[model samples]
Target: MKQSQSHDGSNAQIGAPIPSWKVLIADSQPDQHDAVGRCLASLRHDGRGVECLSAFSAREATALFGQHPDIAVVLMDVGLDGPAAVQRLIEHMDKATATWAGPGLRPRVVLCTRDPDQWPERAAFEATAIDGYVVTAPMATDRLYGAVLSGIRLHASMIAQDSSQKGMARVMVSTAGIFELRSSHHFYFNLLLQINSLFNIVQDSLLFVVGDSAPKDDVARIRAASGRFSALRNQTIAAIEDPRIVSAVREVFQNGRTVQTNEHFAFAIKTRYEVMAVAFIDGALGLSAMERQMIEIFRTKATTAFSNMMLIDELNASQKAAVFALARVAEYKKNLIQGHHKRIERLVSETAREMLQRSFHPEELDEDLVAKVGVASVLADIGMMVVPDQVMHSTRVLDGDSVELIRQHTIVGWEILRDAATMLRGRSILAIAAEVALSHHERMDGSGYPYRLVGDAIPISGRIVSVVDVFDALISDREHREAWTVDAALSWVTEESGRLFDPLVVKAFRTVVARIREAEPDWLATEIASPALAGKITTAKRDLRRMIDRITHLLN
Candidate 1:
């Protein structure tokens, strides 16, 4: 006969403890109080059961954590009345697991928020460190149980990975306390000095950006340490992107978002020539499991760093856009070409999206970046504005002086964009645009100007525009040149692929050109040169197509 365990008048089977599993419940509501206990009482794995712990408030939750280091899973309410805490005690516990705890600790967390979408908690949940989330609603017990089981399995995998990297020597400490490790601090500083021996490790490079105010002192320590460890900090800063990776690191610290990598982000970083690492630093440092109390502390520091990194991408994009805009204005004025810039923008955008879709094995062309590529294309000819009208329109070959002034536009574009760095605070895509605007004239063989940056040194945007810009220019009737037929221009670009263009970009251009032709047979010859004006027509066509597709799919 089977035994039955009683909870809230419901009976659940109870057997021996589940191997490699322990569960904790951190909630205040009586229903959750009853339902969770009943659910836990029923849990079984391979016919074995679970070791369960329960807590009602944030404080009790902490006590439960103290006693049960092997707690594999936690069901935590997002809010707990612990001195008006900005973050739930569950978050605090989760942070502790990831950043400070050793093996036999580091519980996987499941957040149960009443109104998970409100204010800081919502942002915290999105950015915070938790294995999974379940909104408190009817039938939420099922969701809670599933999330817990999944988190436990994943956490076990992470434990395995950390176990593999057990031999690496590193220090795990609080944000401020990190500097206290004299040898590591000294080593970090020495690395910085070797990279740049200027201004004795500038503190400006080491500034921290915090997205939340609750960890005010945490932010202060990271900031305050700059003055004391100026050398170490400056070196760290020099090695980091501006706005600082520290800001993102801090947000992650306070919130503790599960750190996962996507191919798009991975590719973007590589395309931009950056090296990024996500690590379980605490586990690597040989910290004791009881020392898991420092999880929150590590998270705060990591969040600041991560935030700063994201901010850098944003800033870089903004600066690029401003520069491109300025260049476009100059180019438009130079030839009095009203819509030439606009046409280029459309061509570039269409080509890039198509190219990204085709060449990237994982087509992760973000919709946002696709729009940005169009904007960059529109501004690519802006540098041509710095050239005099006579030279711009002249069919005659240019003199040395005229060529020299024209070559200065890339630098000019960069200069005009430097002041509007704030505009770039959140968009990294624009920076790629700026690179395209400034370097579109560059040849694959290092024959381009402003910076004779060859091969991969030239931004992908620059490479992309190289094919699009040239094709547009060849097929458009500019002041000094007769327009070539679409077929002629296409053949020219396709033939020049590796010699004058990125081969992948050239191939993408062909596909886009084909798409445009299929979409509109006479599109190339229609002569809608002004992109802003043509946009309305294009939008209408897109809308109609979407409607037709929806109707067709529904019928199918």
Candidate 2:
């Protein structure tokens, strides 16, 4: 077998002109290879000429493929050694190409034969992955040129498609990861940028969303934008100067369907609750059929992601409402002052924010944890609901038995929240609430509560709520005692730093108190709930019934 080389009878040189396309010609007859090479020596496609690689046997052809991995087309003789040798060469090429170029990126193969009756076109294609068959009895140069060019074009098209598919997969994974991090704006903006990158377009794009509670006359506002449209984010559609884009967006919103026009493409994404939003791709009029199909796939995936985010938001809201209703019921049963839990919630939230600002417990602190610990703090005394009314409301000093019974509320509250958390498949807020209920009363010195946990052994959530809960109780008037002065309560908390509270928590608590004193000195005197807190109270009655029904279902 002869060694493979460029048609010039020498190895390719460093300064040799690079051809736009490479074609391999494999046959046992050296004259056949030379004749085919001579016929196509001056031919060019897309203004660039082709380079031919000569291989004298099946083994030489396989070796040529290894040397030139970028070869776009292969011209093989069906009877090189036998049908078996040709088949073996094809299989080897397939495995080798697929390893580097991927399964969808194999080179195009065109078979040549002297006897057409032995290898018909239909049988040639079915038996092997050949792109074309040429009858070489007369060696028609025109037929040979046409077949080789067609194979090169087909290979180029395959490479384009494979690249598009890979780009789409990467975009999907990146968008999903951003969504998981809970930044909806970042996720949407990243999707738009990726769409442009995938299609090789530099056009402006805009994503508009209309809330479910929006009025009929309300216009969709831009949530995310790219290119020139980026400056107009959070603006209504009317803000865009392009009449063509405005019309397309309106048409999509009105019809609740995708709109394709001569100048733009607008897609209305629908979630379970409503027609979620519209994605406007400006200057997308000339997208090919494949590009359009890829956009549709992206739209479908975006819809699923939108629906999932909405579901999670709804679930979190429902959990918070249930917790508030349950806390209110316990407070009412114990005849505690109104707005007491609300104050505790605010105090806990403030302290948590301060802790995060100070970088305390950096690994465990985040915005989500701050929000959850505050809401869960309201459930710290949920065990009070199980205490007897007489023992809870007694004006007289409590006896030893009464004191022990009162302490049991901590254990009882933990059990209730722990069971509810289990029933909810371990919802994070409930798990934190269970920890607060169980350990909030325990002192840092191992002296307090049912479990007597010491220092950091107690969960951070419990430690945070313990300090804030005590501060609120001391400053608020109770049935058995008058309210202490703010200064006295603050001094007591500062003095009990490590003995009765987590030192880190107490540190944050001091900062929180100082801020409150500076910003809202009369905050403690105002028993009236803020508008937002008042709304929560107004819904408590309605949510109480729902909470009971849910708990009943969980119990069953």
Candidate 3:
């Protein structure tokens, strides 16, 4: 599968397009001739795609190299002319000093081999003018394209950098020339303007200074751009409000490179901004070599302007984390097993990764989300801290007040998160987990707590975590109830899908549960036999009792 796509930072430049470059191939074997010829010909014959020139032998290759200075690449067969042909070819290349020696002529030579191991002069051949090597038998077209593109891009960058350096050197030597300085400034501004134009700024597009200490108006403009972009597109910008993205962008600036995120960040210059405007921006925008180079240039020119803003933000996040930890600590005093947050986070993080890959949803989950899910999972049960020990630990029949107190925990979790904006950013996944914690008790038939968000109204993430939370709770015991059999719990959950849970999320949850059971059947079996199960089964008994009660109540 060709699952790879090429990307570089900076939108595609709308400069005068360089003319298509030609390729040359040198090989002696007639049997090997057709395949190589056909592939090169295919690229060229694809209509203004590429131009190819072929040579039958090393001698012919040298002649062609001399004849066509415009040829961009030469694919040379290492074992072509004879048993010693590959070595001979290397000698010729060495004599000519052709390795990165084509000045003004950007010809990349890649050694093509049937078997790199079998090649007699493999090391010598590799050490010569070859920019790269491509294995020939059953050649993968995608790999071939990748190799070719990589070589070409490298060659282009080298040439481009050299040209820029030479121009700068000339300007430095003639520093007294006003016209040279003026031309250089104009060149830079023009480059920026042209690149901006290539981004195809629509009505929602607003320019913002992207460095750390950039003007306040710059940050405001970006926020405004995000709002306009989201409203025009009618999409939620929660990702923009995510803090990880801001961290990622800071990483890019610190390293002087382009940072990309699908999580909604219109853009941030600093590390502190908790909420960015939510918009799904393509990551390819910031992954290109050109984008990295351009950003490096930008950072060099505006260091102080970007740094001041980001440093302040870093300090703010540190302070916020400290306060949030303190609050969680105070709440934990009432109910222990504070480790539930960490455990749940790990479980959900793993499960979400599986589900994201298995399904075709547009969740755009990456490593960042997975890490956040783990952290948020721990905090999911933080709300349980709000409930009194009597209600949480009771084995006797519970009264309405106790049930309500337990129910309010979810709402409390949400409220707590809303107040901590920094946690809100790094732990956006926590918000989803918080929502799930708040409503995990809800039934599919609009019987859930707080908002009773029915059907799709409950975010997919909430539903996913809800199922996992319930599963973990079910297999574990609580003071109020006994744990249920895994089979019984799965059956009940599956039966209640759509009415009590998301049908798809439920199915995915089941898959995850099944996998875990397969990987460690003894853990499930032991938990089923003894609720204590090494003191980790805190909620198992209560869960089993609740399951029995719910099932019996439903049957009645």
Candidate 4:
């Protein structure tokens, strides 16, 4: 990794070794855009070159976004306004590019406009998502270049994360989604903050949920709401402080139904023991029916998540830590695939639930089975814990001997769960885990290793786990390969249906995947690196074996 130096001690310049970034220029005015492009045509940042893409109008920009998602930065004119303007187009373009259907890139946008007066103000830009901006001033060469370089750096960070910020924003929200609240005011305030951030509700909004009440001695209400309703909190008596709030509360309580508008949304959730929990969101724009529906669906999920979180809180601290430790046990020591177990667990759960809803497999895959599959799948690779780091993290290809040794992990993991008659004596989840660990690698066509059980002989848990386990592995980056897109990975699954997987299970998986992509568009966009290194290492090991065998024959 040493840099070469010239006779005079100056570092030698390499022959175009730096990667090129795709930067698109979107402007209606030919002269302005061309001038900006011409100036920055030869610009380089962090030794990386720039590849320019031109789009004269909003339509062309949209088309280019689909064609080249790898475009790292965009400079668009804002005069088009609304759908046609660069400002609005950036918002729509984020949604369009946030899927694996294309090159899986997230481009940073910089607003460029000829009208100086029309430039976005600091307050507006700070609150919204305009990355950079430039007015049509004469001496803007340095200014524009600075903006573009700054944006390119930001885009680089986004690429490194694989998924864009927009896609991951919902993960936090989803984790907080609980079905019931224990009138925990701390949790309620936090939940309110989540809703506000997710939907971009303003400070002026009156956000509150009234339902079950906690003990007054420990509960801190009214004035301690952190300015959510500062005026209401400051009121001495705290009775009928706001007539608007009173009317809304009364309406929700009386009707016992949900209400919605551009400015408000109300969902009266019935908590455990038939206690009605009235949740209201105010001063948020309704945007569209689809968006509103998305919010409602997330609300339901959040409620469930909340209930689960509460249940977890009730568990002994040691038990909770142990469960989390089990999930993390699959992480590799070196530069290997991280979060593989968790990814498989989530996908398995989703796919199982999706399959259960459909009549394709009928009797076998139901809600109870799906729950078992999810819980069991978490430890699907527990056998890997016993596999040596040499095999798991080997940069070079592993030979048949090594592979065979590593494959024993399935048996090893299952044996630990099943053979441990004392420790795991009556744990249902462990029994399910044992089944998955042993048979998850078994193929539909009897080509899989170990026992090589074929078709339905493979447990449904094993079948579903096999599909998602391979899928997460395929999409995750390895030392040998770049990550494949979600589209590519799923297509590969479809291609392998029946031969390597159950046809009905694959169908169910596809339905689940489609629903997930629909529910969270960003889910479609997240993909990992390829395992090309793994392939190379395997080839190397086999060649070594062949050479050694030939040498032994010569010695004989």
lDDT of 4 by residue, 1-556 (tens): 1111111212123221334777788876667656776667666765566777778777788788778767788887776543236555666666776655233345878877666566555644764477887775673888888888888888876664443344345645544443343324445556655555665545443334342233223121232233355455423223546655556755765687666654556655443422344555555453343345556666666666555544433332223234334555454332343355566667888888877777657666755566557767877777788777778778798999889988898998889867632453343566778888899999999999669998988888999999988876777666667778888999999999999999888888888888778888776443432355345555545654575555445334
Q: All models: lDDT?
A: 0.54, 0.77, 0.52, 0.63
How would you encode candidate 1's per-residue C-alpha lDDT over 1-556 as one tens digit per residue? 1112322212122212225366777777756766766666655543335656667777777777767666777777766563234255545665666566664347777767767555344565566566677786664777777886687677666665574344111113123333332222242333233212211123322332232222222231222123334544313323444332444444444454522121100000011222222221110122223222233334344344434544444444444444344543454355333455666677788877786666542343555566566765565555565667677657778889888887886766544443333354544444555566688889788888778878777777788788887887788775456789999999999888777787878887788888888998876662423435334544544654575555445334
lDDT of 2 by residue, 313-364 (tens): 5566677777877887876665554577888888899899999988998877
Error of 4 at 423 (Å): 4.5
Which segments of model 4 are wrong by more than 4 Å? 1-321, 334-338, 419-427, 524-556
Q: What lDDT score goes with residue 27 in model 4?
A: 72
Q: Write the per-residue lDDT of candidate 3 for residues 196-253, one digit (tens) a residue.
A: 3334322223223332232332232232233244342212223345455445544543
Estimate the lDDT of model 4: 0.63
Each candidate: RMSD to true structure?
Answer: 24.1, 9.1, 23.3, 29.3
Model 3 lDDT-worst window of ten: 1-10
lDDT of 3 at 367: 49
Every model's TM-score? 0.38, 0.63, 0.40, 0.40
